[model samples]
Target: MQHLLSRSWTFFIGLATGMMLTLAGSGLASKPQDSPAFQDAARIYSILQQIREFYVDEVAYDALVDDAISAIVSHLDRHSDYLDRNEFAHLTDVTSGEYAGVGMELAITEQEVTIVNLFPGSPALEAGVVAGDRVISVDGQLLADSDAETLLMGMRGPAGSLMHLTVQREGEPELLNFALERRQIDVKSVSQRMLNDATAYLKINSFTQTTPQEVATALKELALAPQLSGLILDLRDNPGGLLDSALEVADLFLDEGVIVKTRGRYYEANVIYFANTGEKISGISIAVLINGRSASAAEIVAGALQGNRRATVFGEQSFGKGSIQSLFPVQPGEGVLKLTTAHYFTPDGLAIDGKGITPDRFVPSQVVLESLLTPIINPLPLNTVVAYQGEKKIQIANQDNQLRTALQALDHPD
Candidate 1:
């Protein structure tokens, strides 16, 4: 059913604790292994069989498992939960070369959806969907005053799906239109370029399986330039992927220190990650850019670099996800239990779960408000007084703004 798919989940503490106490008093003391646990197991099996045979409607076996997993994981922390087979496949396939969409990460605001970053060779990039372009309409349907995320949901579908979108670019008088057919998105995690003769720009979209090697290659490419002095490591819209990859990437910039430490309920889960003594970019001025979309491994990198005083962090706060999820095999080859096994702390022992990593210098974004939003809710005229919709967005207007800030701060070091 459409209502039963799931994500992060947690258990009810009072109920769970009470159940355990009761079981301890009545069951474990009596039989050690064959008491309330067995009874409850039998009861659940009976109930499930009864529902399948005599229930009002026929339920698929797969649906039953999905619902069961969702219910069981409901009482864990918000970061802990289950992943169905399809979801697990996609998750494990994160570094896979192809996905069906225009291949761009978007930041939605009150009035528009801005392109945060575009995947290389993606339809959006090929059709010139540059960062900072705000979408106005899709397939001739005006999205004026419409929630940008909702519009984006409509954009992704089956492969070969065609979408005609109109976007407003900054400092442009006319809107640009493109007709793009959705295809498998090819991901390019590391993008590097020279901002100037002495400055380099390196962006890691997400920490994927190949990210460590990609980052190494990117750095080598940047180092090819003779006069590279300052570097901008962009993790603005990077939704983190692999923890190990993040650790490896952070090790590249740090000489020696604890990158992060994980605390789990079980002793086996708790662990500490330390950086080795090989800093490829040693003595090079580094500036790390993070925003609301930076999370998980991205936060790990930023916190590690910042905590060690190896980089100047400049931008908005991060997405505040400090928990680590481990995928335990459900059976030999069926599915996996995506368990939120532990909470990770920054090197400086800051709680990053709810409190994100704050930047040293806060630079407000410079956005161009479109005409479409100007008329409609110009919409909650009282919005200025009420709940602001500009919540958590990657607020860097363009790549240059943050890079400029980084270069200035690095040059001055005063």
Candidate 2:
């Protein structure tokens, strides 16, 4: 199945900020009208104006404003951004889950613009853009020292417009240039496939307002198989989304008991979410896949299943992120504070902060053929399955191999 993966540095940074805000809000009362903080803010504004008039180096107003905004946001939290008019509009479009652009996520690291991940079927992917590509220039304009937001702005434009990008790909000496047409790209948050007659695979890319309904529909299709065996819930690179959606998804798999608990500064923010008792899948074996990129809501699902012994997890450790943010609108089309409101924990009382879920069977990902030429049936000898690790890929001849090792274990009861 075609799957899209996303790494969410944004959520990590935002949660850190929210946690600090929660701490500050808990002990401090509303400041007086003449508070020192407000006075300091006024003084700083005046000092900036004075610098513009007296500094030896001529400074552009726009650059100064951008720098000021960046500085302020940097101090508050990672998720809270100071977006100017254009940037604000762009952020809104992206968060709203629809936009017209090249469909690639970019980040700035040490003054170099880097492509993080390109959306599947996007203009950027179609133009051969891959992760880790350094964007040297865009439309003949050098962007090596540009901020990530600025570089992204340069890449985006009206739909149907053409843009040129000069990228440096790994192991390539000559700089490659790509002329791409911008298009309206919709980021899909869900995907499903039948792994076999009885086994199905469902991957949730992200949780959105409509994710619960989408997941329900996918499950219905999987249920169409007369003798459904089990499912492989793949959350390898899912970044996460709305907390409510996470709860809803967990409820589907869990019959009863606490799904997750949240703790925050305010008593009101602390909450315990439970699953409905009589609505769980019985006698169905489930296996979940995770990696360093699986985070937030993905962690919630993994934690729930692991706690209840409902699924056998496989893959590397997950991305350790367990903080929750609550968005508070501050102004009309101006800005908002995405404050950290709470910390979440699995029902088994495991802290997920900086501590990821350890898979029961650690299996490193391997690049297998798109379609297995010869499908192995059940009750095959254990040594026949292949085990791929490191640079050396080896094949086995009988039932004693690793794949058979897992299959044999699954065949026998715990």
Candidate 3:
């Protein structure tokens, strides 16, 4: 999948031409040589050329240039990345909240590709793929030591194409192979259902550009249910997307409260986002589900709900990623830089850097539900209740256990 820059000089030249055209179209004259802006651009170009020609190893010039562009932006902060034309288009598709794929979220772990999450009703999920399963190979090619990005790219293809994957699951004697056909994955950001004909269950996968609208639609549907008792907002294994989307989603449930705030080196980056008037589900008990994989914008929503006591967070601690990245168009066509512009905080002013949103109840990954059941003679004909005694009270029986637990908790809130 690696393309050599020298071999693609035509592409590079075209990219450079496009950048020049964009600059010209802007109608802004080049700054004088004495200007700091001009000098900085010149210096960056010089470094890029030097590394391209004189780097000790045979580096991919295109990748080197992209990395150089990214390095410069990194000094600004963490959210930014250098994206070429293809990368930019792919990014756009993700934010658009729809694309064609097998419908699984993947991550690199210990140099092996792992299934981080599976979209409900996705082909992958229907094929019996589950989180924590290590992908051993793709299309019969060994994927050991391969980067997650590369592995994912290889697995993705046009609709109607097929991808073969070999996976290694924990405590399994044989490797599992699955043949998945590519299809358009319309990412459903929001899904709602009544947990027990009273409590509503809403699961938000990520906060994409359309997330706010999707959440609103789901909320409106759930609100139609009569005598709603409670709500379960599941953010488990959700990696954040759009910040604004997260803010809007929080606003749907919160009434007149600070959702989240951002703080950075610059004063301008320090600002607070507040929930406006109007509560979609006011005066309803709420419980939020989060895990170590819940990060970024997910943390924002969970933190806001927890801080305002709007919801009681349950499950393991969340992934501590509080930094906000702002995309800056550095050199259009050549690449764009994503920079970490700010650090976000909860409504109660709790920092979320290394400290993720701690759940009100800590549920561990072991201890089966069988241990929670108590023998009852003539058990009362009432809804059963189970609470996590400690970290080891719950067990990871399967990939669906987390969701099952969340549903159970919402049904019988202690």
Candidate 4:
């Protein structure tokens, strides 16, 4: 569905209003408008007037204008969009990495809204919400027909607000219910743990505003452990977020080089991001893991590191999403136009728009890894109950093939 708000919308409204005022003051026999700008404006103004005066039924003029404005931007590209007030607010919350909600990431799976991830220290995680749980309803409202945005809007609200949630879990005979309180959730994008005595693992969910700092903190904490010789940077399933966050995260392990470059028609969009003089974690081999779901900023990081010979990327080809979206706020507290502005390139000047980063070593199947596991740990838990942090690391290492391969590569670097 098309939404409303654009930078051009303000100028459009002004032009239409001016034309209407002029038309009202002057007679119908006034000379035809000579200027091409005036001619186009008059044509649009006439149509709007016709709709208001002769349409089959009465329609909200502002709503009609909003829709018209949205229609104008929708033709540009799939990524460019006009965000209405509510959507603009949601975008703000996402980029800022703070919102009042139960703090679970939801995805559409088999035509149902399913829980995919839970932020640490979140109400949903504490309430025993696990991945693969399908949402049935929120506060007694069924979500069979609700889109992800609608479901998110239903889930989020004022802090301290109470909400009832219903979900269907795998291997469970009955549906589960939880009374959850919406709290101010500060999303932690970087999750890190020591894979072994010598290897550190970092999983970046998305490149949020606070992600760079969170990554730095994780590296520092991991550094405290003895013999941290290797680092596994996991970007699998990361859909990417803020571009600056991605650049900073890539810079953390790089020492003086072009991290990534962007090129577009606009001069502001055509620029290169360079790493500073020093690396935070030196003398450590880095392994970056990516899959088909990894995209945008995640690809930027992988490309930068791969181009610089700083890390070996592992797994399937990444999601090719390199176009940049620049948000133009149309009105205060109203909405914004998310316009596609630029295309991203790796440090080596390889464009990543449609061509994703190819992994250095591609492992075709997780099933193969499953077969290789010892019988003692066979039959991994179908629905993992949140285990102790230490046990969780072991489970993660055993369950993911890409991570296991990266760990092996880092441990026995040739």
Candidate 5:
């Protein structure tokens, strides 16, 4: 009881003083100590003290402090959050592009955890767990009502830990069961494939610490230096990641120009990023594909490329999440506070906070391609899916109209 009261008093006193200083800094220095802001601060402390002393049941002081901090920070914006220890760890794992898990990219579809993609050489891939599989449970825990964060926490653990997964695959007679061992899953941020002899298609899942390097390496592997005619950079369904990674990726395509700018109350936040000299692959016509899911760092790259006329953006308007979040560590071994620090602007000086970036050409969702092209008889075999439009045949994993249109545009540039 003594320890709790003493700590609580200290916390409330410090909080009251901080509030007063903030009020003073905001041109209210001449106000009396009994001002509304001061009274509110005192009221908060009094309420907390009362709750601690006279509550119906025992309460955790740490939980109360955490809840107070969360309430204060989260009300600022939708992007800001008070990350708990687990949430902070998850953020680190994502930005680092590495974690101990089965290595399956998952999405919530109709309240079920569905596999979207798999990393190469991952435990999930080796176990024949393909995309479109729905994970019903993890280690005997039913994930029916779990959100993304809970699903991730349940999946990830110490390396070499054994895990069991129950999955529901389409056309399966019964639910598939698999026993897998957790391993270090190094997610590839960038994946590439050739659209044709001269065109290359690169899909970026998310920006991470290794994103720029992965992109550079993919370009090198394409070996299209002398013969490269066109490039398609796909940011479809990407939720975005680190801002620095986005800047570096944009730098690879731009010779020299202002990539993006940020504005905030602090001078440190108000800065501009400029591309360095030279392009990684010069003189190649570029097409960028974005959708409603593309945001933050993803939008940054698309806006930079589009504004500089280095690439033509297609598909749809990007997700408007242009606010910058900076992590402030609360204390050692505690959690961090993710605060919205600034609003970012495109190279054209346009803010995309609420209004997203409009594409140069709007392309609708997947199409049958029957009206636009002449139907040809399947020469390979039955049950083989192939994307064909007009006289050109583009081999794709799936029938994506945006990609098909982008390829056509790049093939015959306007």
Candidate 6:
């Protein structure tokens, strides 16, 4: 109670004094504080006084104030949130895709922070972390009740600093503990490999500033292979990033067309983008893979390519987050407010907010895919059926239904 009162009173007093000084300079300080111009401000102060005096339980006044600000912003949309100074700094680091940390890719699954992937040369990878590992604790703090954002906060640190992680892996009796030193890890958003003799696979984990160049380089390298017949652009489980990066990637394949259009109440927010003369991979047969986790910029690429009839979209529907968030800077070094300025549409004029892009060839993802793709069925005992709840047992050549279907489609493209 004392702490809150001291902090709140200190800040408001200074702010009030500043306003008074400014008004005095304008020769308006002599006006009564109860005047119409100051009515709402006085009322807010009165409410704050009442809360400090009569509230049953002591509350952190600063936290209450920030919560009020967040609540006001929450009325806007689900994607909008309040960011204090620290969170704003973290946001910058995240969008830049460069930070001093372990470089573990995480996904929130049923309120649990689970590892989805890891950067190739990351501290977490060196510490022996793998996909599907559930984070149980961090630095001795249990993560069961911790939110994903809070867990992420604990993951970052200064370079050379050490952090501990405990994870639960399937079929392992002992929990895996890692003591890792933080390093400057640049998350690679693009990965490429030759899937088969004639097909190349390129997986974009996210859209970052360097993604377009990385993709172009990958395509050029793949084109040099004499056996290359098709390319698979995988965006499955990709939570998207920069819109401009996605536009650049779309331009690599599209010759000319409106890639995406955005509309909003603000005059400046309504805009459109069209592909220019930079179609480097126009003649190559391309297949895009998507799932419920693919969103935002990923959706932009999928929608653009699919709308332009440049690629065959495969896999499940995408995660629909078709909105443009513009960051408005506050006073220097304070922070920035990320507000959704416009709702974006596909080139074909479809606004996919809740309804994601439907693939041309829809294959069920995850466990369902395993079941459908695993054509080699084991014979069971007569008059008996047993259920095994564990890791997947089947291993087939074309076990990935989406990839297999994509390969087949590429092989038989008309």
**Pairs with backbone N, CA or C atoms under 3 Å apart (clashes), candidate 1:** 10-74, 10-75, 10-76, 11-75, 11-76, 99-185
Error of 5 at 128 (Å): 6.0
Residue range 1-414, candidate 6, lDDT tens digits: 000000000000001000000000121245577788588657777887789789999989877766666767879865554556766566556545677887776655455766766778888888799877888988888887675555556666789988888999997999999998888877677889886777888998766567799899988887887878788999886666666777788898888998888787877667788999878765678899998777777788899999989888999988776776655544455444556667778999998677778999888742332342445421211122223337654332324667777877787777
In the range 51-167, model 1's lDDT, one tens digit per residue, is 889999998966786788778887876544465555444444443334577776654445455666677777888888887677788778777856443455566567888889898
The list of candidate 5 runs beyond 4 A from truth reads: 1-50, 53-56, 106-116, 125-151, 162-180, 223-225, 369-398
lDDT per model vs. reference: 0.66, 0.64, 0.67, 0.70, 0.70, 0.68
When sorted by lDDT, best at the front, the candidate numbers are 5, 4, 6, 3, 1, 2
Q: Each model's TM-score? A: 0.72, 0.73, 0.78, 0.77, 0.76, 0.77
lDDT of 5 by residue, 128-175 (tens): 999778878878877765644455466667888888988999979899
Q: Which stretches of candidate 3 lie over 4 Å from their true place?
A: 1-32, 35-44, 47-64, 70-80, 109-112, 369-414
User: Which residue pairs show collisions in model 3?
Assistant: 77-340, 78-340, 79-325, 79-340, 80-338, 80-339, 81-338, 366-395
Q: Cα lDDT for residue 203, model 6?
A: 93
TM-score of 4: 0.77
Better of 3 and 6 by TM-score: 3
Clashes of 4: 0
Q: Write the per-residue lDDT of candidate 2 for residues 280-305, one digit (tens) a residue.
A: 44567877788776777788888888
Off by over 4 Å in 1: 1-39, 96-101, 106-116, 127-180, 367-399
CA lDDT for candidate 3: 0.67
RMSD per prediction, one decimal? 11.1, 7.0, 8.5, 9.7, 9.7, 10.4
Q: Model 2 lDDT vs. the true structure?
A: 0.64
Which residue window of length 10 is worst by lDDT in model 2?
A: 11-20
Worst 10 residues of 5 by lDDT: 1-10
- Provide the lDDT at 186 for model 2: 77
Cand. 5 TM to true fold: 0.76
Off by over 4 Å in 2: 1-31, 45-66, 76-80, 84-88, 105-120, 128-143, 166-176, 277-283, 367-414
Looking at candidate 2, what is the lDDT of residue 343?
Answer: 74
